[model samples]
Target: MHRPAVHRRDPRLEIITEAVERLIPRATPAHLTVTVTETLPGTANPDGTPHKHTWTGKPEGLAVKVFTALFGRPRTEEQRSPLAQAEDAKRARDLVGELDALLAGGVALETAPWYPCRPGDLVHVHHRAVGDVPLTPAFGETYIVGDAGDGLMSMQLLAHTLPDTVEHAADMVGCFAAEAADCPVYEVWFEAGAHLLTVVRDGRPVHVGGAR
Candidate 1:
Protein backbone atom coordinates (compact mmCIF):
# COMPACT_ATOMS: atom_id res chain seq x y z
CA MET A 1 0.00 0.00 0.00
CA HIS A 2 1.31 3.46 -0.89
CA ARG A 3 1.24 6.06 1.93
CA PRO A 4 0.01 9.51 0.98
CA ALA A 5 2.62 12.25 1.39
CA VAL A 6 2.02 14.20 4.66
CA HIS A 7 2.12 17.98 4.26
CA ARG A 8 3.66 20.12 7.02
CA ARG A 9 1.95 23.43 8.04
CA ASP A 10 3.88 26.50 9.30
CA PRO A 11 3.59 27.01 13.10
CA ARG A 12 2.51 30.68 12.62
CA LEU A 13 -0.10 29.57 10.09
CA GLU A 14 -1.34 26.97 12.56
CA ILE A 15 -1.81 29.65 15.25
CA ILE A 16 -3.82 31.79 12.84
CA THR A 17 -5.82 28.70 11.80
CA GLU A 18 -6.67 28.02 15.43
CA ALA A 19 -7.81 31.63 15.95
CA VAL A 20 -10.02 31.46 12.86
CA GLU A 21 -11.51 28.18 14.03
CA ARG A 22 -12.39 29.77 17.36
CA LEU A 23 -13.88 32.79 15.56
CA ILE A 24 -16.02 30.68 13.26
CA PRO A 25 -16.54 27.20 14.65
CA ARG A 26 -18.64 25.92 11.69
CA ALA A 27 -16.10 27.10 9.08
CA THR A 28 -13.40 24.82 7.69
CA PRO A 29 -10.00 25.61 6.07
CA ALA A 30 -11.65 25.24 2.63
CA HIS A 31 -14.02 28.17 3.46
CA LEU A 32 -11.13 30.56 4.26
CA THR A 33 -11.46 32.59 1.04
CA VAL A 34 -14.09 35.29 1.72
CA THR A 35 -14.77 38.67 0.07
CA VAL A 36 -15.59 41.72 2.21
CA THR A 37 -17.04 44.91 0.75
CA GLU A 38 -17.76 48.23 2.54
CA THR A 39 -20.32 50.74 1.30
CA LEU A 40 -19.35 54.33 0.57
CA PRO A 41 -20.72 57.22 2.61
CA GLY A 42 -24.08 58.86 1.64
CA THR A 43 -25.77 55.54 0.91
CA ALA A 44 -29.45 56.00 1.72
CA ASN A 45 -31.93 53.59 3.25
CA PRO A 46 -35.61 53.13 2.40
CA ASP A 47 -36.69 55.26 5.37
CA GLY A 48 -34.26 58.08 4.38
CA THR A 49 -31.90 57.58 7.32
CA PRO A 50 -28.54 56.99 5.65
CA HIS A 51 -27.29 53.40 5.68
CA LYS A 52 -24.11 53.76 7.71
CA HIS A 53 -22.27 50.85 6.16
CA THR A 54 -22.59 47.83 3.86
CA TRP A 55 -20.23 45.24 5.31
CA THR A 56 -20.44 41.88 3.58
CA GLY A 57 -18.57 38.61 3.97
CA LYS A 58 -17.72 36.36 6.93
CA PRO A 59 -18.11 36.71 10.74
CA GLU A 60 -15.06 39.00 11.02
CA GLY A 61 -16.66 41.41 8.55
CA LEU A 62 -19.95 41.23 10.48
CA ALA A 63 -18.10 42.23 13.68
CA VAL A 64 -16.61 45.26 11.96
CA LYS A 65 -20.03 46.19 10.55
CA VAL A 66 -21.64 45.99 14.00
CA PHE A 67 -18.99 48.29 15.51
CA THR A 68 -19.43 50.83 12.73
CA ALA A 69 -23.19 50.81 13.23
CA LEU A 70 -22.89 51.41 16.98
CA PHE A 71 -20.41 54.28 16.73
CA GLY A 72 -21.18 56.24 13.55
CA ARG A 73 -18.72 58.54 11.81
CA PRO A 74 -17.67 61.72 13.59
CA ARG A 75 -19.02 64.98 12.15
CA THR A 76 -16.54 67.54 10.79
CA GLU A 77 -16.90 71.28 11.49
CA GLU A 78 -17.58 71.77 7.76
CA GLN A 79 -20.62 69.54 8.10
CA ARG A 80 -22.36 72.11 10.36
CA SER A 81 -24.45 74.78 8.67
CA PRO A 82 -23.74 78.51 9.09
CA LEU A 83 -27.16 79.07 10.65
CA ALA A 84 -26.50 76.40 13.26
CA GLN A 85 -23.14 78.00 14.09
CA ALA A 86 -24.82 81.40 14.50
CA GLU A 87 -27.47 79.93 16.81
CA ASP A 88 -24.77 78.40 19.00
CA ALA A 89 -22.99 81.78 19.21
CA LYS A 90 -26.22 83.52 20.19
CA ARG A 91 -26.91 81.00 22.93
CA ALA A 92 -23.41 81.44 24.34
CA ARG A 93 -23.83 85.21 24.35
CA ASP A 94 -27.11 84.99 26.18
CA LEU A 95 -25.65 82.61 28.75
CA VAL A 96 -22.70 84.94 29.27
CA GLY A 97 -24.98 87.90 29.86
CA GLU A 98 -27.04 85.93 32.36
CA LEU A 99 -23.83 84.90 34.12
CA ASP A 100 -22.50 88.43 34.24
CA ALA A 101 -25.73 89.81 35.64
CA LEU A 102 -25.78 87.11 38.29
CA LEU A 103 -22.13 87.79 39.18
CA ALA A 104 -22.58 91.57 39.33
CA GLY A 105 -25.19 93.30 41.53
CA GLY A 106 -27.46 93.55 38.47
CA VAL A 107 -29.94 91.07 39.95
CA ALA A 108 -31.38 92.09 43.31
CA LEU A 109 -32.26 89.44 45.93
CA GLU A 110 -34.17 91.84 48.16
CA THR A 111 -37.07 94.29 47.86
CA ALA A 112 -34.91 97.46 48.02
CA PRO A 113 -34.67 98.20 44.21
CA TRP A 114 -33.32 96.72 40.96
CA TYR A 115 -32.49 98.08 37.48
CA PRO A 116 -32.02 96.37 34.09
CA CYS A 117 -28.62 96.49 32.43
CA ARG A 118 -30.32 96.81 29.04
CA PRO A 119 -33.35 98.77 27.87
CA GLY A 120 -36.60 96.98 26.82
CA ASP A 121 -35.67 93.94 28.95
CA LEU A 122 -37.70 93.28 32.11
CA VAL A 123 -35.61 92.13 35.11
CA HIS A 124 -37.58 92.06 38.35
CA VAL A 125 -38.08 89.62 41.21
CA HIS A 126 -41.46 88.73 42.70
CA HIS A 127 -41.56 88.76 46.47
CA ARG A 128 -42.19 85.31 47.92
CA ALA A 129 -42.52 84.08 51.52
CA VAL A 130 -38.79 83.55 52.09
CA GLY A 131 -35.90 85.16 53.96
CA ASP A 132 -33.54 87.39 51.93
CA VAL A 133 -29.76 87.08 52.07
CA PRO A 134 -26.84 88.76 50.33
CA LEU A 135 -24.52 86.55 48.24
CA THR A 136 -21.42 87.51 46.28
CA PRO A 137 -19.53 85.99 43.32
CA ALA A 138 -16.07 84.52 43.66
CA PHE A 139 -13.06 86.61 42.60
CA GLY A 140 -11.60 86.36 39.07
CA GLU A 141 -13.78 83.53 37.71
CA THR A 142 -16.12 83.18 34.74
CA TYR A 143 -19.37 81.23 34.78
CA ILE A 144 -21.90 80.06 32.19
CA VAL A 145 -25.60 79.52 32.85
CA GLY A 146 -27.11 76.22 31.74
CA ASP A 147 -30.72 74.99 31.78
CA ALA A 148 -33.17 76.12 34.42
CA GLY A 149 -35.85 73.63 35.49
CA ASP A 150 -37.90 72.55 38.50
CA GLY A 151 -37.22 75.87 40.20
CA LEU A 152 -33.49 75.28 39.91
CA MET A 153 -30.94 76.67 37.44
CA SER A 154 -27.48 75.34 36.66
CA MET A 155 -24.25 77.32 36.33
CA GLN A 156 -20.85 76.01 35.29
CA LEU A 157 -17.51 77.66 36.12
CA LEU A 158 -15.11 78.23 33.21
CA ALA A 159 -11.38 77.99 33.85
CA HIS A 160 -8.35 76.84 31.89
CA THR A 161 -7.67 74.34 34.70
CA LEU A 162 -9.61 72.87 37.62
CA PRO A 163 -10.75 75.11 40.50
CA ASP A 164 -8.64 75.01 43.65
CA THR A 165 -11.24 75.45 46.39
CA VAL A 166 -14.64 74.29 47.62
CA GLU A 167 -15.26 77.79 49.02
CA HIS A 168 -15.68 79.31 45.53
CA ALA A 169 -18.19 76.61 44.60
CA ALA A 170 -20.24 77.36 47.73
CA ASP A 171 -20.03 81.09 47.14
CA MET A 172 -21.30 80.67 43.55
CA VAL A 173 -24.38 78.75 44.63
CA GLY A 174 -25.09 81.19 47.42
CA CYS A 175 -24.71 84.18 45.12
CA PHE A 176 -26.97 82.65 42.46
CA ALA A 177 -29.67 81.89 45.01
CA ALA A 178 -29.41 85.38 46.48
CA GLU A 179 -29.86 86.94 43.02
CA ALA A 180 -32.79 84.78 41.92
CA ALA A 181 -35.17 85.16 44.85
CA ASP A 182 -38.10 83.52 43.01
CA CYS A 183 -36.10 80.38 42.13
CA PRO A 184 -36.08 79.07 45.75
CA VAL A 185 -33.21 76.78 44.66
CA TYR A 186 -29.99 76.87 42.61
CA GLU A 187 -27.51 74.23 41.50
CA VAL A 188 -23.87 74.81 40.56
CA TRP A 189 -21.70 72.54 38.40
CA PHE A 190 -18.01 73.31 38.79
CA GLU A 191 -14.89 71.83 37.16
CA ALA A 192 -13.25 68.55 38.06
CA GLY A 193 -11.62 68.27 41.52
CA ALA A 194 -14.22 70.81 42.71
CA HIS A 195 -17.42 70.32 44.66
CA LEU A 196 -21.14 70.92 43.84
CA LEU A 197 -23.28 73.27 45.90
CA THR A 198 -27.06 73.36 46.26
CA VAL A 199 -28.68 76.61 47.43
CA VAL A 200 -32.29 76.68 48.61
CA ARG A 201 -33.55 80.18 48.02
CA ASP A 202 -35.63 82.07 50.57
CA GLY A 203 -36.50 84.29 47.55
CA ARG A 204 -36.69 83.96 43.78
CA PRO A 205 -33.43 83.95 41.81
CA VAL A 206 -35.00 86.71 39.71
CA HIS A 207 -35.59 88.76 42.86
CA VAL A 208 -32.12 88.25 44.34
CA GLY A 209 -30.09 87.97 41.14
CA GLY A 210 -32.09 90.69 39.24
CA ALA A 211 -32.51 89.78 35.56
CA ARG A 212 -30.60 91.70 32.88
Candidate 2:
Protein backbone atom coordinates (compact mmCIF):
# COMPACT_ATOMS: atom_id res chain seq x y z
CA MET A 1 0.00 0.00 0.00
CA HIS A 2 1.17 3.56 -0.79
CA ARG A 3 1.04 6.41 1.75
CA PRO A 4 -0.50 9.83 0.99
CA ALA A 5 1.22 13.23 1.23
CA VAL A 6 0.58 15.91 3.85
CA HIS A 7 0.98 19.72 3.75
CA ARG A 8 2.85 21.79 6.34
CA ARG A 9 2.46 25.45 7.21
CA ASP A 10 5.18 27.83 5.97
CA PRO A 11 7.82 28.97 8.50
CA ARG A 12 8.16 32.47 10.10
CA LEU A 13 11.90 33.41 9.81
CA GLU A 14 11.33 36.17 7.24
CA ILE A 15 8.99 38.18 9.49
CA ILE A 16 11.58 38.63 12.25
CA THR A 17 14.16 40.01 9.83
CA GLU A 18 11.67 42.57 8.54
CA ALA A 19 10.78 43.66 12.07
CA VAL A 20 14.46 44.30 12.91
CA GLU A 21 14.87 46.37 9.75
CA ARG A 22 11.83 48.49 10.53
CA LEU A 23 13.44 49.47 13.83
CA ILE A 24 16.94 49.96 12.40
CA PRO A 25 17.07 50.83 8.69
CA ARG A 26 20.79 50.13 8.31
CA ALA A 27 20.54 46.63 9.79
CA THR A 28 22.32 43.90 7.84
CA PRO A 29 21.90 40.14 7.64
CA ALA A 30 22.43 38.43 11.02
CA HIS A 31 21.00 34.92 10.60
CA LEU A 32 17.74 32.87 10.81
CA THR A 33 16.52 29.22 11.16
CA VAL A 34 13.77 27.06 12.75
CA THR A 35 13.65 23.50 14.06
CA VAL A 36 10.59 21.39 14.87
CA THR A 37 10.80 18.61 17.39
CA GLU A 38 8.66 15.48 18.07
CA THR A 39 5.34 17.24 17.47
CA LEU A 40 5.69 17.02 13.64
CA PRO A 41 8.03 15.50 11.09
CA GLY A 42 8.70 16.06 7.38
CA THR A 43 10.91 15.20 4.44
CA ALA A 44 12.04 17.54 1.68
CA ASN A 45 11.23 16.91 -1.99
CA PRO A 46 13.37 17.51 -5.07
CA ASP A 47 12.14 21.10 -5.42
CA GLY A 48 12.98 21.68 -1.67
CA THR A 49 9.56 22.17 -0.08
CA PRO A 50 9.10 20.07 3.03
CA HIS A 51 6.29 17.48 3.06
CA LYS A 52 4.62 17.15 6.44
CA HIS A 53 4.55 13.95 8.46
CA THR A 54 1.17 12.96 9.87
CA TRP A 55 2.36 11.27 13.06
CA THR A 56 2.61 13.54 16.14
CA GLY A 57 4.55 13.03 19.35
CA LYS A 58 2.46 12.88 22.48
CA PRO A 59 2.84 15.95 24.72
CA GLU A 60 3.97 15.23 28.29
CA GLY A 61 7.45 15.55 29.79
CA LEU A 62 9.19 16.19 26.46
CA ALA A 63 6.69 18.88 25.52
CA VAL A 64 7.11 20.55 28.88
CA LYS A 65 10.89 20.57 28.54
CA VAL A 66 10.71 22.15 25.09
CA PHE A 67 8.39 24.89 26.34
CA THR A 68 10.54 25.68 29.37
CA ALA A 69 13.69 26.09 27.28
CA LEU A 70 11.96 28.34 24.78
CA PHE A 71 10.47 30.76 27.33
CA GLY A 72 13.58 30.82 29.60
CA ARG A 73 11.80 29.03 32.43
CA PRO A 74 11.35 25.45 33.43
CA ARG A 75 7.78 24.52 34.29
CA THR A 76 7.29 23.47 37.88
CA GLU A 77 5.50 20.16 38.35
CA GLU A 78 3.14 21.65 40.96
CA GLN A 79 2.34 24.60 38.67
CA ARG A 80 1.58 22.19 35.86
CA SER A 81 -0.47 19.79 37.96
CA PRO A 82 -3.26 20.79 40.38
CA LEU A 83 -3.01 24.49 39.43
CA ALA A 84 -3.76 23.68 35.82
CA GLN A 85 -6.49 21.33 36.97
CA ALA A 86 -8.08 24.12 39.03
CA GLU A 87 -8.08 26.41 35.95
CA ASP A 88 -7.93 29.66 37.99
CA ALA A 89 -11.76 29.78 37.95
CA LYS A 90 -11.89 32.44 40.64
CA ARG A 91 -10.11 35.07 38.46
CA ALA A 92 -12.17 34.50 35.32
CA ARG A 93 -13.88 37.90 35.18
CA ASP A 94 -11.33 40.07 37.06
CA LEU A 95 -9.62 41.87 34.19
CA VAL A 96 -9.18 45.33 35.69
CA GLY A 97 -5.82 46.66 37.12
CA GLU A 98 -3.92 43.47 36.40
CA LEU A 99 -0.93 45.25 34.96
CA ASP A 100 1.04 47.63 37.17
CA ALA A 101 2.92 49.57 34.50
CA LEU A 102 3.60 49.19 30.81
CA LEU A 103 7.08 50.55 30.29
CA ALA A 104 8.53 50.75 26.76
CA GLY A 105 11.99 49.29 26.30
CA GLY A 106 14.15 46.93 24.25
CA VAL A 107 15.91 43.84 25.52
CA ALA A 108 19.51 43.28 24.43
CA LEU A 109 20.92 39.78 24.52
CA GLU A 110 24.42 40.54 23.27
CA THR A 111 27.15 43.06 24.02
CA ALA A 112 30.00 43.85 21.64
CA PRO A 113 31.77 46.74 19.97
CA TRP A 114 30.83 48.18 16.56
CA TYR A 115 31.25 45.90 13.56
CA PRO A 116 30.93 46.39 9.80
CA CYS A 117 27.96 44.96 7.86
CA ARG A 118 28.35 46.71 4.56
CA PRO A 119 25.70 47.85 2.08
CA GLY A 120 25.33 44.51 0.24
CA ASP A 121 24.85 42.45 3.39
CA LEU A 122 21.80 40.16 3.39
CA VAL A 123 20.19 38.91 6.62
CA HIS A 124 17.23 36.81 7.86
CA VAL A 125 15.08 37.62 10.94
CA HIS A 126 12.22 35.91 12.83
CA HIS A 127 9.65 37.82 14.93
CA ARG A 128 6.00 37.79 16.02
CA ALA A 129 3.36 39.99 14.36
CA VAL A 130 0.25 41.06 16.26
CA GLY A 131 -2.92 42.82 15.06
CA ASP A 132 -1.78 45.10 12.16
CA VAL A 133 1.58 46.32 13.41
CA PRO A 134 4.53 45.21 11.26
CA LEU A 135 7.53 43.68 13.04
CA THR A 136 11.01 45.32 12.88
CA PRO A 137 14.21 43.61 11.69
CA ALA A 138 17.42 43.40 13.79
CA PHE A 139 20.22 45.71 12.60
CA GLY A 140 22.74 48.49 13.26
CA GLU A 141 23.98 51.64 11.53
CA THR A 142 27.46 52.15 9.98
CA TYR A 143 29.69 55.18 10.56
CA ILE A 144 33.31 56.37 10.78
CA VAL A 145 34.98 56.39 14.18
CA GLY A 146 38.48 57.86 13.89
CA ASP A 147 41.39 58.19 11.46
CA ALA A 148 44.34 55.85 12.02
CA GLY A 149 46.59 58.01 9.82
CA ASP A 150 46.38 55.50 6.95
CA GLY A 151 42.63 54.79 6.98
CA LEU A 152 39.53 55.72 8.95
CA MET A 153 38.19 53.33 11.60
CA SER A 154 34.90 51.71 10.70
CA MET A 155 32.14 51.68 13.33
CA GLN A 156 28.59 50.43 13.81
CA LEU A 157 26.10 52.54 15.76
CA LEU A 158 24.56 50.38 18.46
CA ALA A 159 20.78 49.73 18.44
CA HIS A 160 19.79 50.73 22.00
CA THR A 161 19.19 54.37 23.01
CA LEU A 162 17.22 56.63 25.40
CA PRO A 163 17.27 60.38 24.56
CA ASP A 164 19.42 63.19 23.10
CA THR A 165 20.45 66.88 22.94
CA VAL A 166 20.01 69.90 20.63
CA GLU A 167 22.47 72.66 19.73
CA HIS A 168 23.20 75.44 17.20
CA ALA A 169 25.19 75.07 13.95
CA ALA A 170 28.35 76.53 15.49
CA ASP A 171 28.30 73.81 18.13
CA MET A 172 27.28 71.08 15.68
CA VAL A 173 29.07 68.08 17.13
CA GLY A 174 28.24 64.82 15.34
CA CYS A 175 27.11 62.14 17.76
CA PHE A 176 26.37 58.47 17.10
CA ALA A 177 22.72 57.57 17.25
CA ALA A 178 22.08 55.16 20.12
CA GLU A 179 19.57 53.14 18.11
CA ALA A 180 19.60 51.36 14.73
CA ALA A 181 17.14 52.10 11.91
CA ASP A 182 15.67 48.96 10.33
CA CYS A 183 15.24 48.06 6.60
CA PRO A 184 14.61 45.27 4.01
CA VAL A 185 12.40 43.13 6.28
CA TYR A 186 11.15 39.55 5.85
CA GLU A 187 8.82 37.18 7.79
CA VAL A 188 9.64 33.83 9.43
CA TRP A 189 7.03 31.08 9.68
CA PHE A 190 6.91 29.15 12.95
CA GLU A 191 4.69 26.52 14.56
CA ALA A 192 2.71 27.09 17.74
CA GLY A 193 4.61 26.23 20.99
CA ALA A 194 8.00 26.16 19.24
CA HIS A 195 10.60 27.84 21.48
CA LEU A 196 13.88 28.16 19.64
CA LEU A 197 14.83 30.23 16.55
CA THR A 198 17.69 28.90 14.45
CA VAL A 199 19.63 31.43 12.36
CA VAL A 200 21.24 30.06 9.22
CA ARG A 201 24.15 32.31 8.33
CA ASP A 202 26.12 31.44 5.19
CA GLY A 203 24.23 28.12 4.86
CA ARG A 204 24.65 26.69 8.39
CA PRO A 205 22.86 27.96 11.49
CA VAL A 206 25.30 29.96 13.62
CA HIS A 207 23.25 31.44 16.44
CA VAL A 208 20.18 30.18 18.29
CA GLY A 209 17.61 32.43 20.00
CA GLY A 210 15.11 31.81 22.89
CA ALA A 211 18.07 30.35 24.75
CA ARG A 212 19.79 33.51 25.92
Candidate 3:
Protein backbone atom coordinates (compact mmCIF):
# COMPACT_ATOMS: atom_id res chain seq x y z
CA MET A 1 0.00 0.00 0.00
CA HIS A 2 1.17 3.53 -0.80
CA ARG A 3 1.35 6.06 2.02
CA PRO A 4 -0.31 9.43 1.60
CA ALA A 5 1.80 12.58 1.67
CA VAL A 6 2.01 14.33 5.02
CA HIS A 7 1.35 18.04 5.35
CA ARG A 8 4.62 19.78 6.11
CA ARG A 9 3.21 23.05 7.39
CA ASP A 10 0.87 23.28 10.36
CA PRO A 11 -1.57 26.21 10.66
CA ARG A 12 -1.77 25.69 14.44
CA LEU A 13 1.75 27.07 14.61
CA GLU A 14 0.41 30.45 13.63
CA ILE A 15 -2.05 30.37 16.47
CA ILE A 16 0.69 29.32 18.87
CA THR A 17 2.93 32.12 17.65
CA GLU A 18 0.22 34.72 18.04
CA ALA A 19 -0.70 33.51 21.50
CA VAL A 20 2.92 33.34 22.56
CA GLU A 21 3.55 36.82 21.26
CA ARG A 22 0.64 38.21 23.19
CA LEU A 23 1.58 36.39 26.36
CA ILE A 24 5.34 36.87 26.19
CA PRO A 25 5.28 40.57 26.98
CA ARG A 26 3.36 39.83 30.14
CA ALA A 27 4.10 36.24 31.05
CA THR A 28 7.79 35.85 30.27
CA PRO A 29 10.53 37.30 32.44
CA ALA A 30 12.59 40.02 30.79
CA HIS A 31 15.81 38.21 31.70
CA LEU A 32 14.90 35.03 29.85
CA THR A 33 15.82 34.58 26.22
CA VAL A 34 13.17 33.20 23.87
CA THR A 35 14.19 31.50 20.67
CA VAL A 36 12.44 29.68 17.81
CA THR A 37 14.17 26.85 15.99
CA GLU A 38 13.28 25.07 12.75
CA THR A 39 14.58 21.94 10.99
CA LEU A 40 16.68 22.30 7.84
CA PRO A 41 15.51 21.88 4.21
CA GLY A 42 12.20 23.72 4.51
CA THR A 43 9.06 22.56 2.72
CA ALA A 44 6.28 24.44 0.87
CA ASN A 45 3.32 25.86 2.75
CA PRO A 46 -0.17 24.55 2.16
CA ASP A 47 -1.34 27.84 0.65
CA GLY A 48 1.66 27.91 -1.68
CA THR A 49 3.06 30.70 0.47
CA PRO A 50 6.36 30.75 2.28
CA HIS A 51 6.25 29.82 5.97
CA LYS A 52 8.54 29.50 8.99
CA HIS A 53 8.38 27.53 12.25
CA THR A 54 9.21 28.63 15.80
CA TRP A 55 11.54 26.37 17.74
CA THR A 56 10.82 25.61 21.38
CA GLY A 57 14.51 24.86 22.11
CA LYS A 58 13.65 21.63 23.84
CA PRO A 59 14.24 18.02 22.84
CA GLU A 60 11.33 15.83 21.84
CA GLY A 61 9.26 14.45 24.80
CA LEU A 62 10.55 17.25 27.00
CA ALA A 63 8.24 19.98 25.65
CA VAL A 64 5.98 19.90 28.71
CA LYS A 65 8.91 20.30 31.05
CA VAL A 66 10.25 23.15 28.95
CA PHE A 67 6.89 24.85 28.87
CA THR A 68 6.49 24.58 32.62
CA ALA A 69 10.02 25.86 33.18
CA LEU A 70 9.41 28.89 30.98
CA PHE A 71 5.86 29.73 32.02
CA GLY A 72 5.84 28.23 35.50
CA ARG A 73 3.37 25.72 36.90
CA PRO A 74 -0.31 26.49 37.13
CA ARG A 75 -1.11 28.58 40.19
CA THR A 76 -4.36 27.01 41.27
CA GLU A 77 -5.11 23.41 42.03
CA GLU A 78 -8.13 23.64 39.75
CA GLN A 79 -5.82 24.41 36.86
CA ARG A 80 -3.37 21.74 38.02
CA SER A 81 -5.91 18.94 37.90
CA PRO A 82 -5.03 15.82 35.99
CA LEU A 83 -7.24 16.74 33.04
CA ALA A 84 -6.06 20.34 32.94
CA GLN A 85 -2.48 19.24 33.27
CA ALA A 86 -3.00 16.73 30.53
CA GLU A 87 -4.31 19.44 28.23
CA ASP A 88 -1.26 21.60 28.86
CA ALA A 89 1.02 18.62 28.35
CA LYS A 90 -0.73 17.78 25.11
CA ARG A 91 -0.27 21.31 23.85
CA ALA A 92 3.43 21.10 24.54
CA ARG A 93 3.73 17.73 22.78
CA ASP A 94 1.77 18.96 19.79
CA LEU A 95 4.00 21.99 19.50
CA VAL A 96 7.06 19.78 19.56
CA GLY A 97 5.62 17.41 16.96
CA GLU A 98 4.77 20.26 14.65
CA LEU A 99 8.23 21.75 14.95
CA ASP A 100 9.89 18.40 14.35
CA ALA A 101 7.76 17.74 11.28
CA LEU A 102 8.50 21.19 9.88
CA LEU A 103 12.21 20.76 10.47
CA ALA A 104 12.15 17.33 8.84
CA GLY A 105 10.54 18.90 5.78
CA GLY A 106 13.51 21.27 5.58
CA VAL A 107 11.52 24.23 6.81
CA ALA A 108 13.83 26.92 8.13
CA LEU A 109 13.09 28.22 11.60
CA GLU A 110 13.82 31.84 12.38
CA THR A 111 13.12 34.45 15.01
CA ALA A 112 10.28 36.88 14.33
CA PRO A 113 8.37 39.54 16.15
CA TRP A 114 4.66 39.31 16.83
CA TYR A 115 2.96 42.39 15.46
CA PRO A 116 -0.74 42.52 16.30
CA CYS A 117 -1.34 45.49 14.08
CA ARG A 118 0.62 48.10 12.16
CA PRO A 119 -0.27 51.56 11.01
CA GLY A 120 -1.38 52.07 7.39
CA ASP A 121 -1.94 48.35 7.04
CA LEU A 122 -5.11 46.31 6.80
CA VAL A 123 -5.39 43.83 9.67
CA HIS A 124 -7.75 40.99 10.40
CA VAL A 125 -8.83 40.96 14.04
CA HIS A 126 -9.30 37.70 15.92
CA HIS A 127 -11.01 38.40 19.25
CA ARG A 128 -10.94 35.63 21.82
CA ALA A 129 -13.09 37.49 24.32
CA VAL A 130 -16.76 38.18 23.77
CA GLY A 131 -18.41 41.52 24.35
CA ASP A 132 -21.14 43.73 22.90
CA VAL A 133 -18.66 46.15 21.37
CA PRO A 134 -15.09 44.98 21.07
CA LEU A 135 -13.26 47.62 19.03
CA THR A 136 -13.70 51.28 18.19
CA PRO A 137 -11.42 53.66 16.33
CA ALA A 138 -11.45 57.43 16.12
CA PHE A 139 -10.30 59.61 13.25
CA GLY A 140 -10.04 63.40 13.25
CA GLU A 141 -13.53 64.01 14.60
CA THR A 142 -15.48 60.82 13.92
CA TYR A 143 -15.59 57.33 15.40
CA ILE A 144 -15.69 53.92 13.70
CA VAL A 145 -17.57 51.26 15.63
CA GLY A 146 -17.54 47.48 15.45
CA ASP A 147 -20.14 45.20 17.02
CA ALA A 148 -19.23 41.60 17.63
CA GLY A 149 -22.52 39.75 18.13
CA ASP A 150 -24.97 42.31 19.50
CA GLY A 151 -27.11 44.47 17.23
CA LEU A 152 -25.56 47.62 15.82
CA MET A 153 -28.15 49.90 17.39
CA SER A 154 -27.39 48.47 20.82
CA MET A 155 -23.70 49.19 20.54
CA GLN A 156 -22.31 51.50 23.19
CA LEU A 157 -20.16 54.57 22.66
CA LEU A 158 -16.58 53.99 23.65
CA ALA A 159 -15.06 56.27 26.27
CA HIS A 160 -13.79 59.28 24.41
CA THR A 161 -14.01 63.00 25.18
CA LEU A 162 -13.48 64.28 21.66
CA PRO A 163 -15.93 66.52 19.85
CA ASP A 164 -18.00 65.48 16.76
CA THR A 165 -17.43 61.80 17.60
CA VAL A 166 -20.18 59.58 16.26
CA GLU A 167 -20.81 55.83 16.27
CA HIS A 168 -21.27 54.18 12.87
CA ALA A 169 -22.79 50.74 12.44
CA ALA A 170 -20.26 47.93 12.18
CA ASP A 171 -21.58 46.95 8.75
CA MET A 172 -20.30 48.18 5.37
CA VAL A 173 -23.14 50.63 5.03
CA GLY A 174 -22.25 52.34 8.25
CA CYS A 175 -18.53 52.23 7.55
CA PHE A 176 -18.95 53.81 4.10
CA ALA A 177 -21.41 56.35 5.44
CA ALA A 178 -18.88 57.45 8.03
CA GLU A 179 -16.18 57.64 5.36
CA ALA A 180 -18.50 59.78 3.23
CA ALA A 181 -19.07 62.18 6.07
CA ASP A 182 -17.13 65.42 5.91
CA CYS A 183 -15.18 64.36 8.97
CA PRO A 184 -12.18 62.15 8.16
CA VAL A 185 -11.99 58.80 9.97
CA TYR A 186 -10.50 55.36 9.61
CA GLU A 187 -12.81 52.48 8.67
CA VAL A 188 -13.38 49.89 11.42
CA TRP A 189 -15.31 46.64 11.65
CA PHE A 190 -15.43 43.30 13.47
CA GLU A 191 -15.60 39.80 12.08
CA ALA A 192 -15.05 36.24 13.29
CA GLY A 193 -15.19 37.52 16.86
CA ALA A 194 -12.30 39.92 16.24
CA HIS A 195 -12.07 43.62 15.58
CA LEU A 196 -10.67 44.76 12.21
CA LEU A 197 -9.52 48.37 12.01
CA THR A 198 -8.02 50.34 9.18
CA VAL A 199 -4.84 52.12 10.06
CA VAL A 200 -4.49 55.81 9.35
CA ARG A 201 -1.75 57.56 7.34
CA ASP A 202 0.32 58.07 10.46
CA GLY A 203 2.32 55.15 11.85
CA ARG A 204 -0.31 54.51 14.51
CA PRO A 205 -3.76 53.09 14.87
CA VAL A 206 -6.32 55.90 14.90
CA HIS A 207 -7.40 54.80 18.38
CA VAL A 208 -8.39 51.51 20.05
CA GLY A 209 -11.41 52.19 22.19
CA GLY A 210 -12.50 50.12 25.20
CA ALA A 211 -9.89 48.45 27.38
CA ARG A 212 -7.68 46.29 25.19
Per-residue lDDT tens digits for candidate 3, residues 1-212, read 11112221222232233344344443322123346656345665889655667654312113334444666532222211122333455677876654553332222112212222222232322223234453443222223323333222112223233223334423312222221222122122211111122232233333222122
Residues 88-166 of candidate 2: C-alpha lDDT, one tens digit per residue: 3325532222121000000011110111222322223223332453223232222322222332232222222111322
Error of 2 at 18 (Å): 13
* lDDT of all predictions: 0.30, 0.26, 0.30
Clashes of 2: 40
List of clashing residue pairs for candidate 3: 36-55, 37-55, 39-103, 40-106, 41-106, 42-106, 42-107, 127-194
**10 residues in a row with least lDDT, candidate 2:** 100-109
Summarize candidate 1's per-residue lDDT along 53-160 as a digit string, tens digits.
443354333433443465442222222222333345567786654454343221212211221121112222221122333232233333433345545334444332
How much RMSD separates candidate 2 from the native structure? 16.8
Evaluate model 2: give its lDDT.
Answer: 0.26
